[model samples]
Target: MAIIETRKLTKSYGSIQAVRGVDLSIEKGEIFGLLGPNGAGKTTTIGMLCTIIRPTSGSASIAGYDIVQRPSAVRSKVGIVFQDPTLDTILTGYENLELHARLYGITSALRKKRISEMLQLVDLTDRRNDLTRTYSGGMRRRLEMARGLLHRPAALFLDEPTLGLDPQTRARIWDYIRKMARKEQTTVILTTHYMEEADQVCDRVGIIDHGQIIALNAPGNLKESMGGDLVIIRTKEPPLVKIKALPYVREVKFNDGVLEITMKDAHLHLSGLLFMIPGVECVEIRVPTLSDVFIKLTGHDIRDDSAEDSGSWIDSVARYRQKGK
Candidate 1:
């Protein structure tokens, strides 16, 4: 069953359309990744579903509650970890979870039990009493994850969960995420810049660009869609015409003096390709990655895009909470 569903969901900011006519049905307990370059509507779509930003057209529901009509219920069913940190530095990790539990109206006994389990789950039990101001970035992120899951929400939304973490820390975070999903059967909807991490953790990913989802599928399937082996050749002068004429060649793209060609059986054709294309300084044959898929579909590296257009929505959340106060 779909715990999250949307139809023609859209959010327009005056003359600028942030998210346009997005349709999605995410199954229960599924780990879904929303992949896109900056300003591609990934965050906007997430904001709408999380009820942080209202859609201008269409509708959506989370855990069977209408986002617009029953926003309180929707909020109760989902947990969110924004791209920007929102933790209170003055409070200890334990205090943070305690505050959230109280806000959710969790009974005293249940709240204590839940906080204990979450602290251990995130491996922060030892430092739970320490002020959050002293916590390391990775430790803080794990604490955020634990806090988000404290209420046992039906779904969790994470935006750039491991943006600045080291590789080992990132791996540990993903492990915690998987364990939580399996133990609680909670659906995870996250937006991330790390393609490899998404490919590893997500069961399916949606690639959005220009306020629309251009592709949605499992990582493997999406990468497979890029056709056969990817042969990247660094050449000032590429033999584009001859390469295109090859019957086995799937596609060819040249940018910044590098040729990215997808073809069948690269080992069989690399020698011939090298012979045909002059000034071939380098040759690399590898499988297609999520980054490659993004470049192929969007014509730009996901990292190359500027994030300025993707203004921070966490501030909006702060403002919303201020109103509630």
Candidate 2:
């Protein structure tokens, strides 16, 4: 059954259309990724689905509840983790979860049991009594996740859950998310700009750009859609001007003395490339990654400043809240 579904969903802020005619369906217990560049309407979509923001046009449902007509029902089944931390600094990790349980109207007896289980699930049982202000970034993230799960929500919405954490912490959180999904059989809808995160954790990804979904498929399938292996060659001189003219190469792009070539057969063309361009410093042949696919489809780098800037204001707000506490 479809746990979440949308038809021509849209949201606008005066003259700016943040989301436009988006259609989506996510199955129960599936990990669905909303992948896109900044300003692509990913967060807006999540906000609408979670009933935090109303759509300007179109319709959506969460776990069989219409977002417009049955918002309380939809909200009851959905748990949201914003891109930034939402925990209270003065509250201990356990206290924060307890507060969430209360908000969800969980009974006192069940709340204690659920809190204990959630803390263990996130591997934070050892420090449950510590104030959130004293917790590490990863710990706080886990605590927030636990709080979201306190009510045993059927669908979880995580927006950039590991955005600014170090790589090690990010990996750890990824494992936690996967484990939670499997053990709880909860449908997960995550929005992120991180290519690796989507490739590694999502069952399928929907690529959004300019407030529209440009592509949707499994990570491997999406990469395959670009067609062929990728060969990255670095040299001291420009080669794209010549490489683009090669017989078998489909496309050639060069930036900062690095050439990216997309070809149907890398093995057949690699030797020819080397022979054609002498004194090449480095030649790297690899399968097309999510990043490569993103670039090919979008004609822009995935991690550019514009993408980073879209969420910087939220980050700044989070920092200010942290300082005030």
Candidate 3:
């Protein structure tokens, strides 16, 4: 049976539809990824399923209990790690876990054993008594992870779990998640902006764009279904209509001055495509990837909006609308 199931799940905030009709089925012992840009509804979807937010329309179930009709049961079956840290820094790690166990109504007899196992799983057994504020960013994340799993929920929800950690720390946390998921036979729902993380950790990913899933499949399968290698070119000005007319090209998109196209047997089409397009300065041909799949589906990269890349979005929107006209 599916550990989590949704049918046309949706959420709206006043004038904005944060999540549209979304259907998902996550099996037991599977690591599923919900990947998208900042406001593409990844968190809203997770929030609704976790019973933290009610869907404006549609239905969902966690661990076979309806989210709307049986919220308490759904909550009991799921554990969540939010993007921001929610731990009390003043308290010791052990104290936090103890509190979580008490709040969850974990039996007193099982509380101690469960907390110890969680701390060990996150590699915090030795420092379980230290004040959380004394811990490093990675350590604190690990502690939060441990607390989330303290009750041994059937489903684990991680919202950008390693957002601010260093590379080494992020990798370590991923290892712990994988280890715990396998050991506990838990279903994990991960939402992350990091492409490499989703590519590496998830058993399958649902690519959400503008509040709906545009693609869903295993990472490798998604890449393979993109239909052939990518042939990229840098040109002064891409003739969109002319390029679209090129035979053997499955898809063509011109973003900025970079022209990206997919073709069956890219090696066979690369030289011909480069020669046919005018003002070519550089050329590249490579295998498709998850990032490529996302760009193909959404027409934009999944990047943090705090960076320089954020400013270009206005111009992109303008161009997109003008093209629509």
Candidate 4:
């Protein structure tokens, strides 16, 4: 049975539909990733599935319990780590986990055992007694993960879990998450805007855009779907002229002075491309990546939003219409 299921789930605030119809099914013991650009409804979907907000329509189930009908049961089976640190800065890591355990109604004895296990899981057993305020960003993130798992939840929800951590720290957290899934057989659903993170960690990924899922599949399958290798060309001249003329090129686009080429066989065409286009300074080739797939599908970089406005749904809608939606 699917550990988490959503059928046409949606959320709206007044007239603005924050989340459009979204359907997803996550199996047990799998790490599923929800990926999208900012304001693309990834958080809204997580909010609904986590029962932090009611969906405007449709339904969701967690661990066989309906989110709307059996909220308590569903909550009991799921743990969440939010994008922002939710830890109490003044409290020690152990204290925070203990408090979380109490909130979840974990037995006192089990709580103690779980806290110890969790601290060790995140490699924070030595720092368990230190106040969270004294911890580094990476340390606090690990502590938060430990606290979330204190109740032995069957499913874990991580919203941008490694957002601000350094690369090494992020890698360490990824190891812990993978280990937890293997050892505990826990199903994890993580939301991230980082394509590399999703590609590297998730067993399967759903690419969301404009409040809808644009693509969904295993990372390798999704990359394979793009068909063939990717060749990135850097040159002093504008790429449009050369890119349009290149043979065997499936698609070509230029952004920020970098030329991206998608081809069926990058190796077969590299020599030809170099010979054809002058002023080519550098060439890089690799298998299709999640970032490459995202760009190919969306025609825009995930992190390249220059819009200068922030407000509630009502304001966004009005602005969107005024600017011609």
Candidate 5:
């Protein structure tokens, strides 16, 4: 049986349809990514799978336990590291893990051993006694990760695990995730707006938009679907619509005065397009990334909506745990 499975899984906040009908199956020890822009329903889907929010309709199961029919069993089998910080500011890092260990019913002896090992896994052994408020953003994120894995869950759900973290710190978190999946044989399902994170860390990615998944494939396969290199040009009011009609131009996009072309062959197409359109400077010529694929499928930039509510983002996890269920 698959470690995680969903059929027509969906959720609605009254009239707001956060997640449409979706079906998925994840194997043991696989890292899967749900990629999309803000309000693309990534968090809502993760919320349902993690049991923090009930689905409006449909069903899902993790580790052979139904999510709705067996929430406690599913919760026991999964751990979640949320998008925002959940560590207690006044508490020492070790104290945080100890609390989770106790909540999960881990024995005292096992708790000590697990806390030590988790600190080492996140490279925080030396600073275990420091107050978490004093720790850097990256350090806090790592601590949350360690806490999530303390119970040796069958599946780990990380929602924007590296958001607001530095590039170096994000790289380290990915390493820890990979190591856990390999040595411990854990299955992970993560959601993120960072296309590079999905491309670099996940074995498979599902591109979601408007409460639905538009595409699902490995990062390379999705890029390969682009067919050829891109020639992006920057000019005030460039006629991207006209460019799409040109030979060798597979697709054309104009965002923020930049015209991006998915070309059959950039070498054959660049010179002619450049000569035809004066005053347009070539911004870049390279293969498409996951970000490009999102744009190609969704017809809009991922961050088109302004900032998401930060308070709601962090509170989603903190509020759930504080309920003391």
Candidate 6:
């Protein structure tokens, strides 16, 4: 069953449309990723679904409650971990979870039980009493994850959950997220620019660009849609015309003295390519990746776009919560 659904969901900031006509249906207990560059309206879409930002048109629901019509009910069914840290520095990790539990109106006995279970799940039980200020970046992130799940929400929204962490730390954090999602049986909806991480962690991802969803599928299926591997050949003189003439070559581009050839069964054609093309200084065969799929669909690299939508969205979430009081 779909735990989260949206139809023609849109948000406009004056003339700038942050999200436009986005339609999605995410299944229960599924790890769904909104994969895109920084300014691709990933955050805006999440904000609308989380009830932090009202849509300009269309509608969305979380666990059966309409976001705009039943904001309070939708909030009750969802928990959010923002891009920036929202923990109280002075409070211990346990205290932070305790406060969140109380705010969610979880009973005392259930609160303690949930907090203990979460701390143990994230391997933070050992340092639960330590002040959040003293926790390392990854530790703090784990604590936030624990706190978000304290109320046993039906869905969890993670906005760029590992933005600033190092590679190893990012991997470990993803591991924790997967582990906890299974144990809690909560649907996971995350927005991220990290293509490799999305490929590794998300069961399915929607490729959002310029406030629209261009494609949506499992990572492998999307890569397969590209139809071939990439063979990057570096040389001073290029044979662009001849390369494109080849029947197996799907696409060819020559830039900065390097020729990128997309072809089916690259390994079989490598010898012929080297023999036919002179001045072959280097050749590398690479399997198709999510990044490759993005470039094929958009013409330019994903990172070529700027972070135009990088608003202080976390602050917006805070203000929305304050207004609820």
TM-scores for all candidates: the values are 0.78, 0.79, 0.78, 0.78, 0.76, 0.79
Segments in model 2 whose C-alpha atoms lie over 4 Å from true places: 231-283, 300-325
lDDT for 165 in candidate 3 is 92
lDDT string for model 2 (1-325, tens) is: 9999999999999998999999999999999999877667999999999999999999999889999999998888989999988899999999999989998889998988999999999998999898899999999998888888778888999999999999999999999999999988899999988888889999999988778888889997987777778898887675556878877788888788888888877977688788777668988998877866766665442234334444433334333544565
RMSD of each: 8.9, 8.0, 6.9, 6.5, 9.2, 8.7
Cα deviation of 24, candidate 6, in Å: 0.4
Residue 21 lDDT, candidate 3, scale 0-100: 98
Better of 3 and 5 by lDDT: 3
lDDT of 5 by residue, 116-225 (tens): 99899889999999999999998898899888889999999999988888899888888888887776678999999888878999999999877898998999899889
Candidate 1 overall Cα lDDT vs. reference?
0.88
User: Across residues 1-325, which tens digit of lDDT does each residue of candidate 1 receive?
Assistant: 8999999999999999989999999999999999876777888998999899999999999889999999999988889998888899999999999999999889998999999999998899999999999999999999998888999999999998988899999998899899888887899999987889999999999988778888899998998887889899999988799999998898999999999998987879888878889888888999878977876675442234645343434323333444565
Q: Model 2 compared with the native: what TM-score? A: 0.79
By the lDDT metric, which is better: model 3 or model 6? 6
Q: Name the 10 consecutive residues with the lowest summed lDDT in model 2.
A: 300-309
TM-score: model 4 vs. ground truth? 0.78
Q: Which ten contiguous residues of candidate 1 have the minimum total lDDT?
A: 310-319
Clash statistics: count for each candidate: 0, 0, 0, 0, 0, 0
User: In angstroms, what RMSD does candidate 4 have relative to the true structure?
Assistant: 6.5
Count of clashes in candidate 5:
0
User: For residues 1-325, could you state the per-residue lDDT of candidate 3 as single tens digits?
Assistant: 9999999998999988889999999999999999877888999999999999999999999988999999999888899999899999989999999998999999999999998998888889999989999999999888888888888899999999989898999999899889989988889999987777889999999998778988989998898887988888988787778778877788988888988888877767777777777888888889877876776665544332324343334335533654675
- In model 1, the runs with Cα more than 4 Å from the true position are 231-284, 300-325
Q: Alpha-carbon error at 233 in model 3, in Å? A: 14
**CA shift of 32, model 1, Å:** 0.4
- Return model 1's CA RMSD, one decimal: 8.9
Worst 10 residues of 5 by lDDT: 310-319
Please give the range of 10 consecutive residues that has the lowest summed lDDT in model 3: 302-311
C-alpha RMSD (angstroms) for model 6: 8.7
**Regions of model 6 farther than 4 Å from truth:** 231-283, 300-325
